[model samples]
Target: MKKITDEQLNQYLEIRIKLGEENFKFINACYDEVLLLKKEEATKNIKFEITDFSKFRDFAKK
Candidate 1:
């Protein structure tokens, strides 16, 4: 399995369309999976700390 960029996927889709290929659904599914994985990978390193919920509660009451 080769890693492909979003641009590459779009280009390939264009070529497939031009050639009248029938695998558009499959390719779009792969593209969607790639985007999801990319989003997950990007957020994997994020860290959150909730040290003050009281402030949020006060704000919500207003």
Candidate 2:
């Protein structure tokens, strides 16, 4: 199995977010399916990080 890089994943995410509503839903569903495959195949380790956009906005006001 080929390793997936952070850049590749981010590019995919950006593309998905820019898609139309119906396409976005489809992309999300496919993402879930691919994640399962990645887990099973153990291609590479993946991690998720979340940030609060509101916090960034507050900081910008400073």
Candidate 3:
């Protein structure tokens, strides 16, 4: 199978919508899998360390 860039996902979805259900079902599954992979990479790279929880607590107290 050929790989498509994440940038082309939305464009492909738009085209898929105007197209047929059988084609849309298969392509939409691919699109969902790609979205999951992208989201995983995005969240994986984020540092979730709470370096200043006190500031958040202080603000919450106001």
Candidate 4:
């Protein structure tokens, strides 16, 4: 992930500090929950590649 600019960092800190610790905690929790849900939603079509392993095992190596 790219680092935020100093200006953005200053803005974010100002907003969160103004919101206060208690409110900031709630915001953080909600943000995390939403991010997880959004990630799950985004991967709805994800595919897994299945492979049989017996042929690639140690016994087959020789």
Candidate 5:
């Protein structure tokens, strides 16, 4: 089994907390499915592609 990095774990935790329990589970399930594709590869790479909220702040005026 590959070792999940501490940074990835922390990011996951932050995402979970921000999303709350209900949404957290749903997001986690999606991630799990993606991870399944790289089973036991000894190097797990979890990258989060989140857009900055400030980028959309201008849209609020519309």
Candidate 6:
């Protein structure tokens, strides 16, 4: 995901301000999409540990 330019940010803010509250739904939708993308990107390099469940079998039985 590329970063948005300052010009683009200004344009979006201007349009959002002029459009008022009615445009909130659209803004929120865009925000959700961006947030999802960022979260996906952040997790791309994560290393997950696999837990061994055999050790817990006796506890579960008890």
TM-score of each: 0.44, 0.38, 0.43, 0.69, 0.45, 0.42
- Identify the runs in model 4 with alpha carbons over 4 angstroms from their true place: 47-62
Among residues 3 or more apart in sequence or in different chains, the pairs in candidate 6 whose N, CA or C atoms overlap within 3 Å are none
**What's the true lDDT of residue 61 in model 5?**
60
State the weakest 10-residue window (summed lDDT) of model 6: 47-56
lDDT of 5 by residue, 1-62 (tens): 79999999999888878899999788879889778856646345633345645555768767
Off by over 4 Å in 1: 1-14, 18-21, 47-62
Cα distance off (Å), candidate 5, residue 25: 1.6
Best-fitting candidate, scored by lDDT: 4
Candidate 2 wrong stretches, greater than 4 Å: 1-18, 43-62
lDDT (Cα, tens digit) per residue for candidate 6, span 1-62: 79999999999888888889778778889999999999999999976555646646767888
Please estimate how well model 6 matches the true structure, expressed as its whole-model Cα lDDT.
0.84
Q: 10-62 in candidate 1: lDDT tens per residue?
A: 99878788756567667778889999999999989976469667777899899
Candidate 5 has its poorest 10 consecutive residues by lDDT at 40-49
Steric collisions counted per model: 0, 0, 0, 0, 0, 0
RMSD of each: 9.5, 11.9, 9.2, 8.1, 16.7, 11.2
| Residue range with the least summed lDDT across 10 consecutive positions in model 2 | 43-52
Judged by lDDT against the true structure, how good is candidate 4? 0.88
Residue 27 of model 6: what lDDT? 84
Error of 1 at 62 (Å): 24
Worst 10 residues of 4 by lDDT: 47-56
Best-fitting candidate, scored by TM-score: 4
Better of 5 and 6 by TM-score: 5
Question: Compared with the true structure, what per-residue lDDT tens digits does model 2 show for residues 1-62?
Answer: 89999999999788877886789888779989999987878845644346666777899999
Winner on lDDT between 2 and 3 is 3
**TM-score, candidate number 2:** 0.38
Instruction: Give the TM-score (vs. native) of candidate 1.
Output: 0.44
